[model samples]
Target: MPNNIKFVKESKSKFLTTKEYHGYGQILKISDDGIEKHIVVKPKDPVFGITIKFLETGHPQFSIPDVSIDETAIMLKNLEEAKTFCREFYERRDEFVQDAI
Candidate 1:
């Protein structure tokens, strides 16, 4: 598991708060799911932050040595579909953040 995780100087993972393409930044807020761990991603911009419980497949094994959302956990079957959800959530960030405040 440790081998899969990227280490930054100050932050934890390399993807901790970085946007993949020419997009706004993002942060990975991690959560525990009993035996497994999950994550909720938050955008750096003033968009709505998202909390997600992973819908995962397969089982954990020590021989695997690493884990990741894209590889292990799944919210949507297609990558493009997942991005769509993020964009839509970001658009409504104001409402979500406001209510939380």
Candidate 2:
């Protein structure tokens, strides 16, 4: 199993007019019952926070404080859904990273 994965984000602050950025991340885990779990660390703003919210199906969703800059929000129904979302997010993130590099 993979040990750790780190995702980074870099951007220029409009107010500061300088490159300012940060990262959002989570910790992966396999439970004793052989269930995959994600222990989210620094969640994205306005979507995910420190607390973990689980549903009846054992799925999880988190919320960030005020980062979206819009009324729209992000959510996940299950681990698979979360994975799909992360895949898309990373795909876009990679594009941005490549452009930055």
Candidate 3:
């Protein structure tokens, strides 16, 4: 188990909040109790283009380094399908940030 989770930064939106764990290179959405969801944009396996996982609070895999795809995960074939899933289910939006410009 990881002794600690080092977060580099966090971004909050109306729909969800994301935290980037240092050295992990993945964005996580944690609930008040524990991790709720996470997205792996560039998975090591080309077969699974983007992996979106919805984990229950206090799940054993929460603290593990291995990536387990069970019934709660949806492996999208490509970026476009992943975006569509987010738009429909998560209601994602493309917002322009002035500070980033």
Candidate 2 lDDT tens digits, 1-101: 22124334433433221112222333322112123222222334334433334421335454434445353343333233345444443445433333333
lDDT of each: 0.32, 0.34, 0.34
lDDT (C-alpha) at residue 47 in model 2: 45
For TM-score, candidate 2 versus 3, the one ahead is 3
TM-score of each: 0.27, 0.23, 0.27
Candidate 1 least-lDDT 10 residues: 56-65
Task: Output the lDDT of residue 73, model 2.
Answer: 45
Flag clash pairs in model 1.
Answer: 1-65, 48-93
Higher-scoring candidate on lDDT, 1 or 3: 3
Error of 1 at 31 (Å): 11
Per-residue lDDT of model 3, residues 1-101, tens digit only: 22222345666666666544322223333322123344332333344445445422212121222334661243423444444433432322112111111
| lDDT by residue for model 1 (15-93), tens | 3332121122334343333343443444333222222233121221111213355554332233333354455445544
